[model samples]
Target chain A: MTDPRLAYVQRKTRRRLAFSAVHLVLYFSFSLNWSSWGEPLSHRLGVTQVTGSLLMFILLVLIFIGMEFLFLQMESKETQE
Target chain B: MKAMFLFLLRSAPLLVLSGVAAAAGSIDGEVEQQPLNTTAIVMFLLFVVMTLLITWRAAKTTTSSAAFYNAGGKITGLQNGAAIAGDFMSAASFLGITGLIFVGGFDGMILSLGAFAAWPLLMFMFAKRVRNLGSFTFVDVVSQRLARGQIRIVASIGTIAVVIMYLIAQMVGAGKLIQLLFGLPYEVAVITVSALVLAYVAFGGMLATTWVQIIKATLLLTGVTLIAILILARTGFSFNELLSLAVEKHPKGEAILSPGVVFKDPVQIATIQVSMLFGTLGLPHILMRLFTVPDMRQAQLSAFYASLFMGYFYLVLLVLGFGTVAFIYGNPEYFDADGKLTGGINMAAIHIASAMGGDILTGFMSAVSFATILAVVAGLTVSGAAAISHDLYAQVIKQGEPDPKTELRITRIAVFVIGLVAVVLGIAFENENVAFIAVMPMVTAASVTFPILLLSMFWSGLTTRGATYGAIAGFLSSLLLIVLGPQVWVSVIGNEQPLFPYDYPGLFTMPFAFAVIWLVSVTDRSARGEIDRANYHSLLVRSEFGEKAAGEGAVG
Candidate 1:
């Protein structure tokens, strides 16, 4: 006797968990590849390691800001619906 | 191979004697050698003036219990985000970790990176739930469906234990810094730092503390970035050259860039890494910052920013650590006449700075380090004050309408009490490896708090009895294991045998807590009906959208 409501909640939880898992794997893979490949590119680009790190940091910050805006816009759309 | 064996045999006696001397009188002599310079004196005065000014400003907004405890719930996410960075970037981040990497090499950097990796998990999992709950203590999130009284008691105990442990660590660090830079006696230094931190938080409240943290973080980042650039210039911006120089100096240098060379035991390394990563999310001081953000979105953003900043800072520390080994470690001038590395890791950063530029640069860096200690101690005091005054006093015992004015006074008193206790503990543990010992208490807090917090937010069936039992089980098990573990026994009784060979017990304790909560919740049918339909709906809505949608739905 599975409660339909509990089943629905479980389904949603599983989806969210799957999304998070994917995101985490992507992040880990990208960081590893970048650390290995990015170092030489940084040198070739005439950027010191510190300068290269700062650039990456700025990029990360912008990505987060963009995500926040996107999330907020989606919330607004949901409210209208 | 034969030469290496002879070298080890020759050095063993000196190492043994030094260890014995460190336990006896080494710290006291080190304290006497360095006195406070004019720059350090001026910086201390400046900190005092700034603290007073901020406290005065915070006094205007702190008119109620809510404002005093949580900045009136009006702080924007960006502001709160910066404060979160401030709080997380303690003396441990600035001085301790940097020193660790300088002395211990790769083992230290791994610890930092492992701790930093936990931030994303915290953001994705805990932050939104914490923000939606809008409670002062972490227990507030876990106890949403539980009896208020039960949650209050359990939460207060966990909060108190964690705050005390953290405060003691900060106090010890402050004492050590004072001894190194100011030549003050350890007892005097501990008292001075404790009193100053208490004053800042007692008067400033959350608003003042936030501003202080922001200022501290700004100064720290600026100082370190400058030092990193300077070091790069000195090395002609050649990363390979620096590495080669380090390798040439010590054949073991390459091992530093790689892992597992220092610890050797595979099991110990795995256990330690797991503990450092997961235990990070459960830290009480870190958790308290989530309550400061305006909404869930801000919470997530703030965590992302913190991780980025922390990662950048750690990379700089890698430079500083290797820079010290290359430039200052064996220099005759860096050591005292006895051939001892007289100043230890605290001097590692400034020595390199001096070598790069001159005495002027060293003075400036020292001032920055001094500011780092003050700022970190202030943040620790405020978080501890919140647990004592808000969680224990207003929510738990009083249960009366929280009068802001009276609560502020109580918070001040609480700060004083916490500061006094820290000073005493700092003095007692002056000779021990304070940073390593400090991590144990945080581990205990994380083990207890993390499982209960996670289950409560995600598991709708988490019952009151289950949470209470789970928290108690996690707290007691972790605490007992740590006390009986090698670190403590080695500190107290000179014993080498570890009860649980693992330095961190989270891998064992966290799952145990989750199991207890599940088992108890399953058995307790009475708690099945405790969930509020409206509140649960609001939580789900708030997590997905933001607070505005939840508010609109409530009105509709």
Candidate 2:
């Protein structure tokens, strides 16, 4: 079995990496002003503006939730160990 | 003089509340002439009644400092998430950031995005460590490996400073909101908010604060989502069309879609973003909420949930802010005779509500705004109370010998005192455009509290003297720079020249804070410094592995 302390560190490191990746995406989007792309993206995707923003929002939420669940799963494993 | 002062202080709340009632009554004729938002008033009162019931329940559960400060660590992750969101997304956010977007467009989005960026960092860096180490206050975490009494004294000073600054900002926002939505006098609004906040916090403590926050967050999220849907429906659900309509309706035309309206320089922009990022990480009330959860996992989950909710809420703000231009831009009902936006631009969200769903929806949004202000103020008061009663009175003053009864009593008295001070300052700054006041506390938190906590947690070389002096240095420098900065210097002090060129001091002072702690710790050769350095290994182990070590129960 993996050392629980080492496993905890690995899990934490993975979360940090995931967070950094998301932060990078956000930073570049805001810096390059690509956040305003939802309007055009919606038009190209043949969706309403509301749907476009909502879809984007739902996508971001899913990503965050996925990352969180992974972290929690690792935490549970550590506790079980 | 002292006796008279004591008597006046004791009767102040009653005096203020009665004065508010009389002032509210005197404006009856004018208020009657204007169309009444009776539905809004009724809904607001209903909310107040419901929250009071919650507080009454919470008061019975609050018996010890653990219960008073942390709600016995029984709050679920989701509930704590909502409460944290409530504490964060205050009236300033609902009104101020939306107003920023309505006026400055992309720049407002940038300001808001900066605020939201702090959450991911909170989850990554501080949330778990803070939850694992602290019970009641963030000071508990900082003092865990240091000298408890002295370190807490310094931490309390930082806590109360941030609290008072944040309180004044919330109070001003509440006062202005009531005046706009209910046509009440500003002083009366300030007093009314203070009274309700005091009742909840002084009686129910953290449990009530958490519930109030959770309820307000739910209401605010629901209300904003409804308005966003209405606005999108108006625009045929097209983001492009919404932007086009907003540009056409707004006086700035296509300039609204471009950045650099409010914040011009890139350095200034970066400074504000840094302030927002670390500032939220260090806010006393927000940090205090992390302790309300059961354990590190709950704390982590709470951060995740809060970030998700806030991310969605902020995106909704983007819609609400830009949608105002499409819907309410030229509406005479939302404008003054001079063609200015009524209640300044901050009423954009409310105007959008009125335009979309008429009086009932506007009333609901108005009531949510009131609840938002009240909930945030209650959160602030509880944290400020813990700083005073837990950190100052019990730990520092009484050397941790105070009984539970005395501690609880001190906490209640601190709540009253903090509420009264907030009211007085809120009323005094009524005409001062205190909207920007919210940013100051965040900057101060980033500068002072963030450095001290981060250093104490991670650095083995950091001593008690270093933490205390570093905190003082960071605290004083941030406040001093803000005073010398353009906002206070030219605007508040009516000066021709600002000593500090920047509006925000975070970029400079945050680094300086870290440097001061480094310099102080590295140079110190004292026996206490040696002991504190030696204790750092255990602190690191506990913070990293969730193991209890020495000083875990030092404060409690």
Candidate 3:
């Protein structure tokens, strides 16, 4: 029989991988076709041209940082259980 | 292709730094040797003295193999995370990328994001399992559930191969910087850097190395923060205004705001992104830092902190890059007689530093650059030494249990050998095509190290024979593709056409490696293969629960 801890940790690992996969997909979509991706976003947002491209890049990086925190938070939840 | 290929970095500066080695006197055009900046000398000397004193203290407790390899796993996640950032952010890379943005504008932000993609990848895939399973080097983790001796032999070959190339490029780059900064002769600079690296790893080990990294990271972060803040203040704290002013001054004008103005190619992007992604997974210095943490959670925290710091750092570079353009681009005082920026484009961040706070801040940044070289090279040397001592010697030659004192002695000896090798190679290859040397470490990491590491942890069917064959295949194929590819074949060998068309082979080679390992493993019906498959259960339990998992599994 599988240990409950193994089951719990595996679920956590799956979630981490799933989240990271989503992040990679976001990154790769832009990276692979950045010309098109940046074209629409390159339009000026408000007072500046800090448009879709820069905003999207910033969001991706934040998600990069946020994914780890999200994982750690999930980890804390497990310990409580 | 060259522009895209430049994005593959364990540390971003090493790639541009290779060119800086050659760009010293010839390309910068009539730029005379920089005078010995007294402030820089004083700052560097103070840093060296403090680090050496730390090394002396570290030497006292570095009596066992664990202390030597990983500081007895005593580093907290926050501290280890800062060290990882220091190791990742070479002063050269930080300045180099910022300078890139200073010249090219928005594209540099893309490259920063590209380099940063590694952090999430590492946190999800490598950090947790590697910390739980790996003891000293990556080889320890890779060899855990397999045939230990044979698997280590394979993994160690990859580690040592990658380390040697990475170490040599760093040594050569450090030498060039020292010569440029201190106005010293080239050979003297190489030897001096080598001597310091020997003192750090051979004597003080990881404790001294970690502290040096932490200190350097703190100084670099502070310098970048101060410079970013000072530059933003000039534009009334409005990032949009800064970009607008940059558009006005830049030669390319509004085109600088577009993505493809400098470079945009889909395949090239995929290739660099692939290498940076997988290469981070397989980089020995980073993988080595994983074991320095006490547990898996701390390991996760370390990667997270590194990501947070790097994210903040990259955002600053984006602003500072545009800010430098707005302020310094057309400013005649900062440019040379030919109307080029003095000391080429890589000096963009330095010029901004001078503008921000005059010679004092510039000198501090310069000293931090030199300190960065030391910390990076020291980490590489330790990883290389551990590959020789812990993986090859103890795990392979001594059958996995060498005497502690004996292993420690072997590690120090290996350190000396690598130091000597780096010194000789640094001086010998000073004028050679450094780009060729720069990409080799990534080829091995992306193809061999990352593939095997991923498969070993995730696959249940892997056998020793399959792993060995798979690793050797991946390493050779990647190396061959690189030699036949654009960077080496066309750029270095003067060929009209590259046999392999891409700048990097990882986009093809990584998938090929996974296929080879899978194909070989599934076909292996040997009894040992069965045992290898069965061992994955306990390996999984141990990896998930760490050392607290007793015997076969954890009993919560």
**Which numbered prediction scores highest in TM-score against the true structure?**
3
Query: Which residue runs of candidate 2 sit more than 4 Å off their true CA positions?
Result: A1-81, B1-36, B433-436, B551-556
Colliding pairs, model 2: A49-B237, A49-B238, A49-B239
lDDT by residue (A8-68, candidate 3, tens digit) is 6677667766987887798787663355644677676767767667787788888777777
Q: Could you give candidate 1's per-residue lDDT for residues B362-389 as a string of tens digits?
A: 6666666666666666666766777778
lDDT of 3 by residue, B159-204 (tens): 9988888877777667666655656666876798899989988999
The clash tally of candidate 1 reads: 0
Q: Give lDDT per model, in order.
A: 0.60, 0.74, 0.76
Ten contiguous residues minimizing lDDT sum, candidate 3 chain B: B21-30
CAPRI-style grade of the A/B interface in model 1: incorrect
Q: What DockQ values do the models have?
A: 0.11, 0.19, 0.65
Model 3 residue A60 distance off true place after TM-score fit, in angstroms: 1.2
Task: Name the better of 1 and 2 by DockQ.
Answer: 2
Per-residue lDDT for B537 in model 1? Answer: 43
lDDT (tens digit, per residue) of candidate 2 on B202-273: 889899999999999999999999999999998898877998898787666665666644545666656766
Would candidate 2 be rated incorrect, acceptable, medium or high by CAPRI criteria?
A: incorrect
For candidate 2, the lDDT comes to: 0.74
lDDT of 2 at B47: 95
